[model samples]
Target: MPSAPPPVPPPQPISDLPHLTRSPPLPDFFLAALSLFVFLSSSSSRSFKLPLLCIQSNPRRFLKTPSMSFSHPNSGRTPHDAHRLHPFASPQSLSDWLKPRLPSDSFASWGVKPGTKNVHNLWLELSEGETSLADSTPPIRTVQVLSLRIIDNHRRILLESHQQLSDGTLRNRNRPLSEKMKPNETPESAVYRAVKEELGSILGDSDCSEIVKIVPDSYKMKIEERNSASYPGLPACYVLHSMDVLVEGLPKEDFCTVEEEEYANSEESSIADEAVSVKKHFWKWVSLDSLDF
Candidate 1:
């Protein structure tokens, strides 16, 4: 009788049960949208490709801009004005403009006439007051020079003597064969021209390729020096390009070569009025260990 009484109690509703509450079932449309979203996400992950990012370890290895082109303001000016001084405001501005142009192949190929004055020569004119620095301040100048470390199979470096004055003293320190780079000239072109000009007497009329080989991807350095000895009181920047040149069949002993240099009789003389001065260049090949520089 007691067990039948206990079983008589009715079952309690889920909403009325202790610690229990009824929850409405999720709508069909909501469930369907959720399933569709998950399915599309899974499919897209398999079907689409993500773009990859490449980072360069060395930022200097590439230029930031895709292409850079500069046109000289006096490119199309008359011949008289072509040689006129176009001074840069500062050393940084000059460096920025000249760096890219240093590797250019040719101005004529680009349909521009080459100016008479390169940076070095222009500085001479400006510093001498042959032409005004105009409204530009910080009248700094830059020069691009190409130097060659001519090496033979023996690893001996070739060096050339400085200009010998008539008074039997050297005008400057002995250094490697070098040349001031011309406007719109490539380093390769400047190398070829320098070798041909400096070593032509030794190499004869033979092609430069037959006599020497330029080592590719050689060391590069840039140095800024103030108060050049040549131009006193004037700050100068030297953008030097040094390259290794492999030469063949050169004399092991010392030798001599003659180079003709032109000088203005007076500070006011024009290019046409320059006087030619012929001087002898003494050359020697020394061991790498014995070299001071």
Candidate 2:
């Protein structure tokens, strides 16, 4: 009469911070549907996963905060026009659409190409209601954190700090590249901007593209609770996103020459400086095994 051991207990709901694992491949439509459900049901404070159909190793590059607003990257098209061009049903038509067909004028109007930008937008659209839900609750703070990974041939990683260079190796040195998210900027875009600011002259247009291999997933998400000096009394939640970056075309020695020859103060310098300027920072490469816990 024990009711068959309480029917084996209902499966527990997935934890807000689920174990980090490679998400398995799922049907595109099913994945989309699941993402929509999570977005609509969860509060803004909670971290949710959007279906990542594209799998890659080293997917843990978690993008930090900023209330994301999705729009077309290409110019000349209104948001509505962009939406019309890239309807969910059309791009996801894994059947006929995937097959090549004769070119037609209609093809040109199909909208902006699917990339990181719109994919984020799609997540927003699914979870649009969460914003209102959040409005009803006590306010939660948002922070955007950007990080850069500089690795050497021995597989050691570089750690940077703004602290005095004399602090020595005992003190914690954070990964050098980090910045708050700017208005209407994506995490990856923001990271690139910071890179240019930090090492533009040395990098010399060499885009960092090679990423290390890790569990494959669409996006990396992490949530933590902590207190900071700026807002000591108030409790806080931290959302973190990080990615490994490898710069192509960098020479093995003398990363880049910094010429002391100063340019004359002129109109060109003023204009050029506005776009990109060197930032002051320090770097130290440490072996992965040598990190003091």
Candidate 3:
């Protein structure tokens, strides 16, 4: 059968066909050119964007420089001043800087209570990542304080002595009668509140109302100073509103007063009455000439 047509060479496998056999390897340049052509064709037809690759000798030189200036509506600080002041230049900056340094909870852990309405509390809240005081008036870093210059007929000034017990040791210092101005509280109201809170145990309500008198326009002065003593490293401005006060019913000589501080059993304790300990505060009267004023 004609040798069966050479066994008809069972249909040659498609992969084994002559044209399908591997050809000579392409030149490296030719293969690269073909790849570029294909890439350009695909890129022109595609709707997607390709990220631009910029080759720079100095990458840092091409990088954007961070701004050194900050602006606040109420603060008239210049850019140079802001740069120098740094984090204290703006409320947001101050909050950002203080957040990591201050305690997350109340200031009681710091051995003092700045009060519920104190500006330090506001800063603490802001540091806690709250935006409530972002648009409030007077800025967050500006602390308003009312200092009472209580004088007697002998010209002796009433100064409160603070003694804090830390690690079983007592640290003492003396300061004038002062309180932070509460939110929306007037200077006059703050003065009265401070008097009551500090002298309530010594003087009766009727005596406070009848005997205590704030001198009219008595050398009132407002001054701003950096507060380095209260919260160390806290870049805060203290706006002191000082006024002269006259109280008729106090000891002419130095006297001691104890303020009982009740703290919670734990740092996370929520119960208001779960007191674990008590701390005392001592007060006295000193001659005005003795202070540096």
Candidate 4:
């Protein structure tokens, strides 16, 4: 008797397959600090707005005008707040709802509704270990990044620059601390790691009375590759989550600025040196009133 054909194996998800992706390396602590200083100084001292560019992803279609701010005034719900209330908040929610539905009834099949174009901004890119059924082009990736606006007890905000800026270009600036969240990491935990990684042991002593306060409210932005030339092919989408954090008891001695270095000796730099064109990072603290945005 002919035996039945060997049982077919279940197809594995794409993430299970090997894939290659590249990201800039974290600079040395000194260089990172210096870059932060340059960013804060240039940003605060100057008045310039970063230009938003529309991308033409499809060669057959013309690029539409870019609209700043995904502010949905009618909903009156911030993205973070609305996210929790969303029925499709998790893959399970989507699966449970989609399992019985016909493929033709999918959200994409429904033509975009008027004034609802901004809805796409609400969909977050896949996070680490999160899988999607959607097809992905090689090298194209989605990364979750965190941005912090650190307010110390003195009511000052810390700012840093990780990107090198041209003489007159608006600063590519961020908070003194921001990082990609690790797998299984919560936003609050990610912020704490960022502080420890960037600020060192100042907040770690047993007698330290410093208080770290996190604002429950958070903001997010979806940045497309076409919008910024810096990130070329892969990492096509950057989902930035912004937080306002407060920490007390940061001593005055630990507060200082990093000087920008024009060049570096590659022989001694870290492996991350191979991934970036700019080698410097700077940081500074500015009063709360100094923030214009």
Which model scores highest in TM-score? Answer: 1
Residues 161-268, candidate 3, lDDT per residue (tens digit)?
764442333545578887655433557666777777666666655446667788888746575656334443334556677888898777666665544332222222
Model 1 poorest ten-residue lDDT run: 61-70
Clashes of each: 0, 6, 0, 10
Which whole-number lDDT from 0 to 100 does residue 147 have in model 2?
57
Global lDDT of each candidate: 0.55, 0.40, 0.52, 0.45
Model 2 global lDDT (CA atoms, 0 to 1) = 0.40
Number of colliding residue pairs in model 1: 0
RMSD in order of candidates: 13.7, 26.2, 18.8, 31.9
In model 2, the clashing pairs are 57-214, 58-214, 61-242, 62-241, 62-242, 63-241
- Ten consecutive residues with minimal summed lDDT in candidate 3? 61-70
Segments of candidate 4 deviating more than 4 angstroms: 1-139, 153-155, 162-176, 201-210, 218-235, 251-281
Query: For every model shown, what is its TM-score relative to the native structure?
Result: 0.51, 0.37, 0.49, 0.38
Candidate 4 residue-pair clash tally: 10
1-293 per-residue lDDT for model 2 (tens digits): 65555557666566533674556779999999999888877877777565879769764332222344435222343333323332234223411331233133223322232111122222222122111111112223345455555556676665654322111212233654554443345556655666655556666666543322222332344666664222222234555555555554444543322322121222233322322122234555567687652
In angstroms, how far off is 10's CA in candidate 3?
99
Question: Sort by lDDT, best first: what order?
Answer: 1, 3, 4, 2
* Residue 202 miss distance in model 1 (angstroms): 2.7
Pitting candidate 2 against candidate 4, the one with the higher lDDT is 4
On a 0 to 100 scale, what is the lDDT of residue 274 in model 2? 28
